[model samples]
Target: MKKEFMKNSLYVMIIICVIGFIIIFSSGAIGKSMQYNYLQKYENAVPSNQLERYLNDITSNFRTAGQVISTLGGFGILLCGYAHYKEL
Candidate 1:
């Protein structure tokens, strides 16, 4: 029963990792589109330099989030793989 639980947990971790991978792949384009929309919405209200900086910061934050997610997923997958190997 414990072994079955462990195996199931590992499978769940793998699925989460795949979801993280998908987020990492999609975030960039999503960020770009969001940034563009934000800029367009505030075209005249904000100065170009300030708006650009803000948009850059937003994009950077999104990228950082993606990186962190990817790192966690990678680590989780690696740990599960090691556990599986050791079990065998």
Candidate 2:
């Protein structure tokens, strides 16, 4: 039962990521709001502090995720080819 719960949570995470990826991929308002919010929070704190650094780290993770989308997209294409090749 614990394994099943973990599987469901993972599925939910993947779906959420896909939705976030789509929204961010389009360069939409969600991305804008997130950026703005981060900027505001960073500015409210003291300059050259840990909070600012942490926010930068979070944004970098988002950028890394964009890179992953491309990697996954290519892998998905390769999977399609393999499926087709096996069908013959």
Candidate 3:
């Protein structure tokens, strides 16, 4: 039934939100740790080596992507819920 589908959708969305939170937090922590490690090693110098630059760029991109996904997923969930509610 539509109600069951809606409930299932909500449940899935809840799980997705939790996953998003984990992704955001873990990515952020990893990024910060990488930055700190670089600073400690280089005495506040920017990443001069190719490997360091690549790692920093990848981590930064992942963190940004995780945050954006989390936000968009949450909004999508809200919209889905609203749409389902109106249907009911």
Candidate 4:
């Protein structure tokens, strides 16, 4: 039962890690696209309007979320590795 649990935990951690990676990459791509569009529209100026600021905030939030999720996933993966080692 314990071995089965450990195996399931490891699988869950791996899925988390994969999801984290996907989020990180997708957020980066989305952010870059947003920046590009903003730059094209505003010509290198910082966000000065409410809408622009809102868009910027959204991008920032996505990046922050991705970073947090990835970090958590990394830690979870590390913990799973440690558990596996201990079980062996």
Candidate 5:
């Protein structure tokens, strides 16, 4: 039972890591697209409206969330490794 639990936990951690990476990559792509659109519309001018500022803030938050989730997933993987080693 314990072994099964450990195995499942490891799988979950791996999934989490994959999801985090995906989120990070998607957020970066979104940011780049946003920049492209802004430049096309405004020609290098900074975001001036509240909606634009809000969108930037949301993008920043997504990046932060991705980083945090990835870090947590990495730590979880390491912890699982340590536990598996101790069991052996």
Candidate 6:
């Protein structure tokens, strides 16, 4: 049961990683800004409007949260696999 749960967790993490990649790449323009992340703030300063700022802030927060959850999911899968491995 633990083995099966970890296996499913790995697959879910992989799918989330793919979705994150899509968000990080699917902007309309090569340099278009959709998220005003702390790192992104200085880089994507061209679109300095209220709407863009709001969009950036919101997306940045959500994306960052998504990334954190994805990372946790990955770690969880790895730890579970390692535990199962040790039991073998």
Measured against the true structure, the TM-scores of the candidates, in listed sequence, are: 0.70, 0.42, 0.62, 0.68, 0.71, 0.50
In model 4, pairs of residues that clash are: none
Ranking by lDDT: 5, 4, 1, 3, 6, 2
TM-score winner, 1 or 5: 5
Pairs that collide in candidate 2 are: none
RMSD per model, one decimal: 2.4, 8.1, 5.0, 5.0, 4.7, 7.7
Q: Write the per-residue lDDT of candidate 1 for residues 1-88, one digit (tens) a residue.
A: 7679777877777777777677667766767787778777877576778766766777677767777777777787788778878888
lDDT of 1 at 76: 78
Candidate 5 — which pairs collide?
A: none
User: For candidate 6, lDDT tens digit of each residue in 13-60?
Assistant: 677766655554443332234443433666645544754666656666
| Candidate 4 CA-lDDT value | 0.75
Which lDDT value does model 5 have at 83?
Answer: 94
Model with the higher TM-score, candidate 4 or 6? 4
lDDT of 4 by residue, 9-84 (tens): 8788778777777776777567667767777786767655754665667677777787787788788879888988
Compared with the true structure, what per-residue lDDT tens digits does model 5 show for residues 1-88? Answer: 9988988999899889878888887885777577667667766666557446746766787788888898889999999989999999
lDDT of 2: 0.57
Candidate 1: pairs in clash: none
The candidate with the higher TM-score, 4 or 5, is 5
Off by over 4 Å in 6: 1-48
Instruction: Flag the better candidate by lDDT, 2 or 6.
Output: 6
Better of 2 and 4 by lDDT: 4
Clashes (backbone N, CA, C under 3 Å), per candidate, total 0, 0, 0, 0, 0, 1
lDDT of 3: 0.74
Residues 1-88 of candidate 2 have per-residue lDDT tens digits of 6556545654555555575566446544445556567668768664555554655566666666765765565555555555546655
Best by TM-score: 5
Q: After superposition, how far is residue 42 of candidate 3 from its true place, in Å?
A: 19
